[model samples]
Target: MSVSRCDIPLPENFRPEDILAFHRRDGERLAEQVDDHGLKKGLLWRGLPSCLELRFQPGAARLSLAIDGAAAADDAGRLASLGRRMLGLDQPVEAFERQYGAHPQLGRLIAARPGLRVPQTAFPFEALAWAITGQQISVQAAVSIRRRMLQLCDCRHSSGLLCHPDAARLAGLDADQLGQAGFSHAKSRAILALSRDAAAGALPLDAWLDGVPVEEISERLLAVPGIGPWTVSYALLRGYGWLDGSLHGDVAVRRAMQMTLGLPDKVSQPQAQRWLQDFSPWRALVAAHLWALLQAGGF
Candidate 1:
């Protein structure tokens, strides 16, 4: 195994530990591990199991990364890209903060957690698959099912840590296999279709990240079997790190909005949608803040 290391600069007030904690929250033992030093995650680099370690100091302005395993020594460009996505470094956080830092509804929340970000999966297909798994399910249930699916794929690094399975590994799976991992029939078909489409290059998953119009990407994703507005929006948010996707349809978003608004009645999807429209390009970022509110015990 080879080892490669590099340091990535961070923007002012960017908090790497918050990103670390988010990844740690739903960590499946085999796929990744997180602690004070930083995150040690298993992933596939060039179709080989590789380990990525991120180390940083509190209040530091940079992150140090170490990539280990086969083909790990070179590929500086790919590893840096992966690190940025994993840390949400490409997000227009400062822009969002500048626009909404003083807004009445979100101002306080943003003030309390200035470093909040919408953490993304390492791969686009991973986000899509996770979105399918989470459809209409409780977060806890989704995590359990996701852990099971990871075990089912069984792609492990040389260090014996399991890597998050890529589209090809997932595409080879059948409905029965997914069902055994707690996927409903509809979800199984949806994930299988998404995996096959991605693995076969039928879906423009990567291009969506490369400046495609959001409407076109949304339309394409919505065309897939069993994919709905919520799934498409969520995949766009988590996969592309796009902050504009409307997440009002999400139950947690509505619930958190209700709490933020101090409303006695539940915040309906339409009501939340209308309210969130005010944030426009930052709607999803606002939604992320509300979700963080709930996670931070504000609800």
Candidate 2:
């Protein structure tokens, strides 16, 4: 496959390294390689396995991009769109800062990391799959299972990088197949059902990106078995960049909140919900900041 190349303009003062650091947090991930300078990951574009390499152009406000294995002639436009979404170039960080910069609890966090932006999955289904894989497990354990799933799918680019399995591929799997990847029975059932729905076009994961009502989307996602507030919120955040999904049910968010607020005990889900309500409209962003605070040992 021929390599397709392009240069994507970066937002002013945008630190691509921040995004790289987030991707590298759990150590080297399968299907992807992350370094101090860039990320190289395999993606399924129109069900075609392709390797995308993004390198930051030092001292320049642009990213040098190369896609190996994409065949479309007009891949540049697709590349730019993917770059903007994956890099969060379109996130309204300034608006978030203006609204919450002086927040008593989050003020310091915002000041500390003004360039923070939520990195999104290349596709919504990947986010949904990740949310299901990560349920009730430590991040490291989830990463292990995800790696196994990728290996089981056996989708790879010519360069031998694993590609994240798309819905059709996942929908074809039985519980036993996923069990080998360490998915519990309940999670396997959930993933299979969701994938089948997605592959059948019953679930419009892509359409939801087009200004769907958050409540409506949340309701639809909740109707799926084994999916709850946390999974839906996480999928929306990473999949749609929807920022206010009430992530109070998240254990890490609660732990971060407890420490950030100087509480001796972790706050209950309901309590965290009430406290996060004050942040409204940006609750997930607040959660991101709290996670950053926890990561930085500011608590």
Candidate 3:
């Protein structure tokens, strides 16, 4: 197996654990996908022919990134880019804390985990596929299904680490085929349809959707079979690193907001949307940190 290693520089106040926390929050093994250390995320970089298993660790001023089983000779640049994006290395560490860090609810978690950074996948297609698989289900249930589906269909490197399948591979499967892999009819159709679009180059891939108007991008992705407001917002938040996307419709978002604000019951979607406006520019960070709060037992 070919191995390539690089040290990607980080912005100030970056902590590796802060980003890995998001990966571990579900607590279930994604078909033995995530463990105590690094995990796999798929990427078809510059036509590498197959996905590389990327595992990274954060350090004092840089991330120690390794790509095990990579085939491309010049894949280092792509790996560095993905490392920066996945680790939230571009974020100004103190900006959010400086602005809303002292708030009664948000402050509790922020003060304790000052380095909690919002992490994203290396690309959009995998994030969208995961969002579809995870829609409207309990985290435990969704992860169970994902674990099954990935084990059944995704590509695995020699290390036994699997990468979520690419559009070309997934596009060829029928809904009935995916049904056997723990997908509901709706999710099956969504996955197949999205895969087809992506494989055919009809939908945006990776950073292609970046810098497009949020409304325009939303319209395009919502046109997919299973994408909705929550999925779109969730995808944009992690997929494009856009902090403007709100998690108002997410169950976790509502639950966290309710407990943080001490509300009697779950807030309505409209209420959640309006309430999230309080965090406005940092809504995506707010959502990640709120989810982190649950993992940290703050709520």
The whole-model lDDT of each prediction reads 0.80, 0.81, 0.70
Give the number of the best model, judged by lDDT: 2
lDDT string, candidate 3, 43-95, tens digits: 44443323334354464323233334445767666666777777776666588
Which stretch of 10 consecutive residues in model 1 shows the poorest summed lDDT? 59-68
Q: What is candidate 1's lDDT per residue for 1-299, written digit by digit as tens?
A: 76656567776777666777666756556677888767777877666777777787554323333334445445776667777887788888888889889888899989998977777888788889888999998887887898899899998877777788888999999999999999999999999998888788988686667788888888888888989988988888888888888998888889889988999999998999999999998888898898887773111
Better of 1 and 3 by TM-score: 1
True-structure Cα RMSD, model 1: 2.4
Clashing pairs in model 1, backbone N/Cα/C closer than 3 A: none
lDDT (Cα) of model 3? 0.70
Error of 3 at 113 (Å): 2.1
In model 3, where do residues sit more than 4 Å from their true spots?
25-73, 207-210, 296-299
lDDT of 1: 0.80
lDDT of model 3 at residue 26? 45
Ranking by TM-score: 2, 1, 3
- Candidate 1 regions exceeding 4 Å error are 58-74, 296-299
